[model samples]
Target chain A: MSQALLTVIGEDRPGIVAAVTQALFTADCSIGDASMMRLGGYFTIMQVIDYPRDLGSVEMALDPAIKRLNLRVHLDPISSVALTADMPNTRVTVYGADHPGIVAGVTGALAAIGFNVIDLESESSGSAERPLYVMVIQGYAPEGVESVRKAVVPLREREGVEIGVHPIEAAVF
Target chain B: MAVLSILTYPDPRLQRKAEPVSVFDDDLHHFIDDLTETMYAGPGGVGIAAPQVDRPQRIVIVDVRPKLGEDCHGLMVLINPELAAWEGMAVGREGCMSVPDFTGNVIRAERIQVQAQDASGRERSYECEGFEARAIQHEMDHLDGFLFLDRLVSRKIDLFRRKQYQK
Candidate 1:
């Protein structure tokens, strides 16, 4: 029994998930946390799995299923390690015209402030000639939201982007 | 008079729509008391709904004065509440006791007017904004089988794994 990280990438289409999960089921693998989504135009699946079979058998099980759909797959063994102990405490959003350095500037501002980003999702839309960029970032800000708000102000001005920071509120109902 | 046990998410009961409260009596008052006690029983809870305790009634008790101050209506017991009007929109981080261990950004009306009835069955209305409105809206969602998770800005972008729910 071993834990492995599996990644699948292919054109977005229906039945992609059903095919992959079925292969895992047939291979007798226990699926862990999985994120299956369409990024840009490609459908991707990232899953952590525990397999009782050998690596070859697991690969063979997935080979036919993914290949038939013209998808690419990779599997790598992973050992548990604590990457960052800080949980997300604030949400930061960025919106501006698409440019070369929006990401670097925004992340640099955050890094300079000692904010550790936990998750980031970004997209660009609008016409090809006038594309708009928007990014949402969640991070651990031990010092709180005001600091995050302040840290981004300089980048917001420099990059000509609108940035907003909100402290994560955990209100019980 | 008694602290009621709140039902957490995936219990199915939390997903059941609550029935409108039609009768106002001593029993209703007692249940409201239990709901209030239960709300206070949780850490920093400012509002609660009857459905959270498996009561399946359109009742909510809210007290935001502790956080928002004198401008708020303070302790409010809203029964059969309905959204009368709302204006503007803003995104705020939200969490819920029902679905603990996660928080997400949820867009809510910046200001809202709510129509409801008090414990005596008399009609009442409240207009509030900011966190007070957010808290009331969060509790009202329970009556309709909605959790704050249902209102997240975006499933892919808003959710951050782990604790703290600003429901």
Candidate 2:
């Protein structure tokens, strides 16, 4: 079996998921892992699919649905790899006044230290006059927790944001 | 006392509702010891329930003191514990030994008053706050066959796979 990664972005509306999944079903592709969410005014979907056919066939199958939904679709062949296990996961949260370089400055610091961002979400709240930006990032840090904290200090100062990095502990019953 | 093996998700036994502990005898004492040993033996474990070890009884052991230091009430052995009063709400990420390999954001009461019987079968009550309250609530859920996954704030965003534990 071959694996493919598909990302669909379009205006927020109902039935987008159903239409996309129906197209994948018609193509005989099975979804492995998927995440769909509404970010501001747009809906975004990221999915990993397993299929017996080639990449072109999967893309062709989704073409009509993509066009009808007025969605932007990006498809690529991906290697079927198992998820990393036993890696330390930390949640890094950054919040402060709305600024243009918050994402880049914060993520750049983490990326420089080889941290892999597994999940991220950000939103701007408050008011137009005094907007606040909040970003929550869940990532795996190979260098451990202290290193991650130390790495973000520069970004914290430069971005003028409150940054907190906490280890995600799972409670054993 | 023995450090019993913790039951993981889909184990069937973890789903079984635990019956209230009525006759607090030698067996009950021994079981509580086992539960305590199991909780301490597990890395970073602050609480545990009898059902996690395949024993369906309303008995749980919580000791956030080791991790929380002077801020906690040391080891808390709650038998047939009940939530008497609760106020406020807060969301905290929780992972369970019985549901290994995953964690989720769970909204629990910020402060709670729990009424329970001690291991000696004496009636007792404790007013706990913060992390202690969260741990107690987490262990208590096991008595009702509820995992942290059931209380997740949002499955779409809050649920996450368990990775390495960082100190």
Candidate 3:
């Protein structure tokens, strides 16, 4: 078993990550995977750090750091299910006049079909004269399926927009 | 007739800058045929470039016609196409076969007009907007030895890996 999941969120500034990492280091915690991003005024950090498997030592390992950093920490035992199996790359693209429900409709459709939305990014700009809304979503197509063709027909019709799906580049290591 | 193997990244051949297709001859036609076959042979690809199939020549084949709806039929265009004009801005998360295993944020033009020749040897120019335009520009960059990796602006952070090579 790996360590607990560690998430820290606060204002963005120099040494926030360093301060948190320094605390983890002193406690001898191993980081599994992590990501930090900033939106407008807030900086957020999410990490999966591994600790000894013993449940007894879990709180002992994490409490000191949580107290020292003054950052909120959520600790959950890492399970085998946390490790997602590699799946084939699948892509979803949506385009329409910039409007609401574009994302909800598309993402809702994907969820209905059992598609996992691994990553998504969207941007909309330009005036009403030439408004453009574009989104790219990457996912994994279910195994044993030869195609996702016709899967997005309802999405296209309901959203009144263009929706495209194709298998993403399969990276053979 | 040859169905050349589509080279994934790190093959070294994919990194070469293709020479301009000055020969509008039989060899060029053959190259186009191979590129078409290669594009269709992949899982589901809408475009292919000369460099992708190990031939470093200024040629690209794009067929968004298949992706078009019943109201619109996509065209399988052969472009020696030069981008003539562009406007607006777009940020997208894109991935490529050359840079397999990763996807990144890429910023590109929203609309463009490209002047070029079709598959039939007659000269034609395409005024592309939206997805078609983006794909055209993306594939055209291959002729100059550019991959989508060069356009990446950021990573998903959590998705980042220690060793990210196109192997």
- CAPRI category for model 3: incorrect
Better of 2 and 3 by DockQ: 2
The candidate that wins on TM-score is 1
lDDT of 1 by residue, B54-158 (tens): 999999889986677788899999999998988766677777777877776777777889999999999999998988899999999999899987887664444
At residue B136, candidate 3 shows an lDDT of 79
Worst 10 residues of 2 chain B by lDDT: B158-167
lDDT of 2 by residue, B3-52 (tens): 89988888888878999888989988888888899999976578998998
True contacts kept of 1: 0.78
Give residue B19's lDDT in candidate 2 (0 to 100). Answer: 95
In model 1, which runs have C-alpha deviations exceeding 4 angstroms? Answer: A82-84, B69-71, B100-105, B149-167
In angstroms, the error of model 3 at B156 is 11
**Every candidate's lDDT:** 0.84, 0.85, 0.67
Model 3: per-residue Cα lDDT over A39-84, one tens digit each: 4566677888766445355555546654665556666675646566
lDDT of 2 by residue, A136-173 (tens): 88888989878899999888788899998988765544
Candidate 2 is scored at a TM of 0.80
Pairs in clash, predicted candidate 3: A3-A50, A3-A51, B18-B56, B65-B74
DockQ per model, Cα = 0.53, 0.42, 0.06
Question: Would candidate 1 be rated incorrect, acceptable, medium or high by CAPRI criteria?
Answer: medium
